[model samples]
Target: MIRVAVVDDEPVVRTGLRVILGSAQDITVVADCAGVGAVEAVRDGRVDVLLLDIRMPVVDGPAVLRQVAALPRPPAVAMLTTFDAREHVDEALRLGAAGFLMKNTAPEQLIDAVRALAAGRRVLAPEAVGQVIDGYLLSGRDEDAVRRVRALTDRERQVLALVGAGLSNRAIAGRLHLAHGTVKDHVSAVLAKLGGLNRVQAAVVADRANMVGTGPGRR
Candidate 1:
């Protein structure tokens, strides 16, 4: 089962998420707490995925995310918010958040996101992905980013583009007609070449550099 922790200042939001995620057979709500309690919850290391609220009192989501990132084995985090703001999305991704979901997300999608994060895949809501891409474009760092991306070989560039599209290694392998191990190697090479900390960062680089085609969805 995928162990999940929910962190939000609102009791109602925490309870709602617990009930919704608890109903999924593959997911268990292992912990539900407010912002202050989040630090301890993640430190226990039982959580595989953490659903963190962005606007909590005192601590807030980004702060909690930083704490999680510092853990010995941090759980995959998904920032939860009421709306998709560029700053929130950028901050979350920069802090190693594996996904971004609006509080209004459907129950099934929320559950799937938790599962995806647990599986070492990313899960960005369509709108959130768009915002991240838009933020990248508006940052005006495309020339520098593209210069870094161009350091990659052609095959690595192809893998980077698909990674930018949020495709998992297995999916990228299937799409590129390559072995899973080969895809993994290429991804590592891409990350090294782009100086990215993770797949999400590599994806951001590809998007910012306009190395990949951009659109509405994770395709």
Candidate 2:
């Protein structure tokens, strides 16, 4: 089962997430807490995914994410917020958040996000993806970033583009008509070539370099 922890200052939101996620056969709501309680939850080492509210009373979601990053085995975090401000999105991603989900995200999508994160895939709400793309474009592409991406082989570049589009290895395989294992190899090669810690970090690099068309609204 995929163990999940819900961290939100609002009791109602916490309870609602627990209820929604608990219904999934493959997911279990292991802990539900306010901002402060989130520390213990992360330290417990039982959670596979953490659904963290972006704004909280004393300790905010970003601060909590920073703290979790110091842990030996931090859970994959997905920031939940009503706002899609560029700073919030960028900061959370820099702090190692695996996903950025809107508070009003559909119940099934939220569940799917948790599963995706648990399976080591990055997830982003459509608007969040747009924000990342826009922010990168507005800031102008880094020449070094472009050079780094251009160094990749043709196939690796294809894989990196899909990774930037937030497609998991399996999804990229399906899209590229390659075997799952082959996609995994390409993903590893992409990471090694890009010098990224994970898929999310690599996606950020690709975005900054404007390496791929992230679809319709991205430009």
Candidate 3:
């Protein structure tokens, strides 16, 4: 079974998530806790996926994540968000979260996201990612990050943006119309150029650099 922990301040939100995730036979809600208990829940419960809320009254998502990231084996973490908390999400992204999930996401989609995350994959749709990245770019400029990203080649920048969006090699290949193997190569090169940070960390850099690509979802 895939173990999942839900961290939210709202009791109703936690309960609602438990019900929704419970419907999946292969996925289990190991612990439904508040941000205060986030680390303890994951550590004690042997969680495989963590659904974290960034808007808690105390003990924010990124703060909890800092503790979790120090664990020998932290579960895949997807921030529980409502789309308006871009800055908070970006902060978490730099600290290394798997991705973000909309609070109002459909039950089926949420289950799928859990399953995918448990399998060590990202959950955002490539098409939808572009618009969110655009938001990050518009939020403000990170001149230092932009300079770091500017050192990359144009194609590398595209690959970096897709990676920042939490896309896998296959999805990125599809998005860029390149072969899967080639995408893997680009990923390796991108990491190398970014001083050998992991994909999610590199994503944070890409985010600050404002290089995450745009999509049709943008108005």
Minimum summed lDDT over a 10-residue window in model 2 is located at 134-143
**Model 1 lDDT per residue over 3-63, tens place:** 9999999999999999999899989998999999998997978889999987776888888
lDDT of 2 by residue, 62-168 (tens): 89999998999999999887644554555676688888788778899989999999988788776466655544445454345557788888888778877887777
Worst lDDT 10-window in candidate 3: 210-219
Task: Candidate 3: list runs displaced more than 4 Å.
Answer: 83-87, 123-141, 164-166, 175-178, 195-219
The lDDT values for all models are 0.79, 0.79, 0.77
The superposed Cα distance between candidate 2 and the true structure at residue 60, in angstroms, equals: 1.4
| Model 2 lDDT, residue 170, Cα | 81
lDDT of 2 at 74: 93
Error of 2 at 35 (Å): 1.2
Clashes per candidate, residues 3 or more apart or on different chains: 0, 0, 0
TM for candidate 2 is 0.83
